[model samples]
Target chain A: EDKVVQSPLSLVVHEGDTVTLNCSYEVTNFRSLLWYKQEKKAPTFLFMLTSSGIEKKSGRLSSILDKKELSSILNITATQTGDSAIYLCALFMEYGNKLVFGAGTILRVKS
Target chain B: NAGVTQTPKFRVLKTGQSMTLLCAQDMNHEYMYWYRQDPGMGLRLIHYSVGEGTTAKGEVPDGYNVSRLKKQNFLLGLESAAPSQTSVYFCASRRLRITNTGELFFGEGSRLTVL
Candidate 1:
């Protein structure tokens, strides 16, 4: 079975602080890693990391995949109250379209 | 574009009752999936379909069944509702041949409560 584990299940940070969420996985035939942000409804796509060492960024959020280490990290700099949400990481299998997701890290940013 | 849509945004069912959750995608995606989200655990796939007329069991397929009779519709059915089955269900779809990136577009989600 494929497994994905995330660190720091929950974290609380003040505004303007920087936070890093970690996700590590074990799977056969790795294809890509995806990050999502969930508030009240379904999760929204944040980034998709396919190549290792190459960083993908969107505004205050950025993510990088380390295939050799079998892990990925999502970084949020200059965080705001609007950044409070559950961050999810998922690993897609190579052959099939199956995605194994982590338990997710819940972030709370206070102003 | 209504990328993905789930019917009955909220539902309540008694123990032993049955219900079917409908999912539809207008993007003409070839892949459709059903997942359940719990409080601490992330979304777990209950079932999925790679294309029309084909369904596959996922990580946690027990107590749940799925059908993909059409190209754009996937239905998840609970034979007998249980309290443990109460959770938020999400439907997602994606194109397979276009990319290996695996970016799944999700629906608003359906909250199911079993009393």
Candidate 2:
């Protein structure tokens, strides 16, 4: 069965701390993976990774994919209280035009 | 553009009640989806449509139904609500093209409570 699993189901950190969230998948015909941040409501896109070895970054957030390991990691540097939210990992299979998601990691950045 | 919009941001129903959540997208996306989120279960796909007049079951499609009568609209119907079905439902849409990034645009989810 195709599934995505995230580690450290919940985390707590002080401001200015760095945290890494992990996502691993087991699916047939892998295509791409995406990261989303959910606050009080809907989730917003954060990054999309299609290839391995390369890193995608935006300000204090970065992510990398390792296709060989069938895993990905999202790193947040200098966390802030505003950064507290649920981080979600999603993968798209080459078939079915469906996006499978993992149970998100709840992040709490204390000030 | 309104992007993706879901109706009835919140609803409460008794067991065995029926209701429908409406999702409309203005981005001309070719694909639309409905997902439910429970406390610790994260988000699970309920149903999706690749194009107008088509619908398919996803990982968690039981107790729910869907319809896509138009290119921009997808509707999720609960034939008989149950306490276990109380959850936050999210609607998303994405364009279907090889060149596209395959990013899904989401709407503010609908919160449903079955008592």
TM-score of chain A of 1: 0.96
Which pairs clash (backbone N, Cα, C closer than 3 Å) in model 2? none
Residue-wise lDDT of candidate 1 within B22-105, one digit each (tens)? Answer: 999999999999999998899999999999999999988999999999989999999999999999999999897766688899
In model 2, which runs have C-alpha deviations exceeding 4 angstroms?
A: none
> TM-score, B chain, candidate 2?
0.97
TM per candidate comes to 0.97, 0.98
Q: Which ten residues in a row have the lowest lDDT in candidate 1 chain A?
A: A92-101
Error of 1 at A89 (Å): 0.2
lDDT value, candidate 2, whole model: 0.94
True-contact fraction for model 1? 0.79
List candidate 1 stretches off by more than 4 Å. Answer: none
Docking class of 1: high
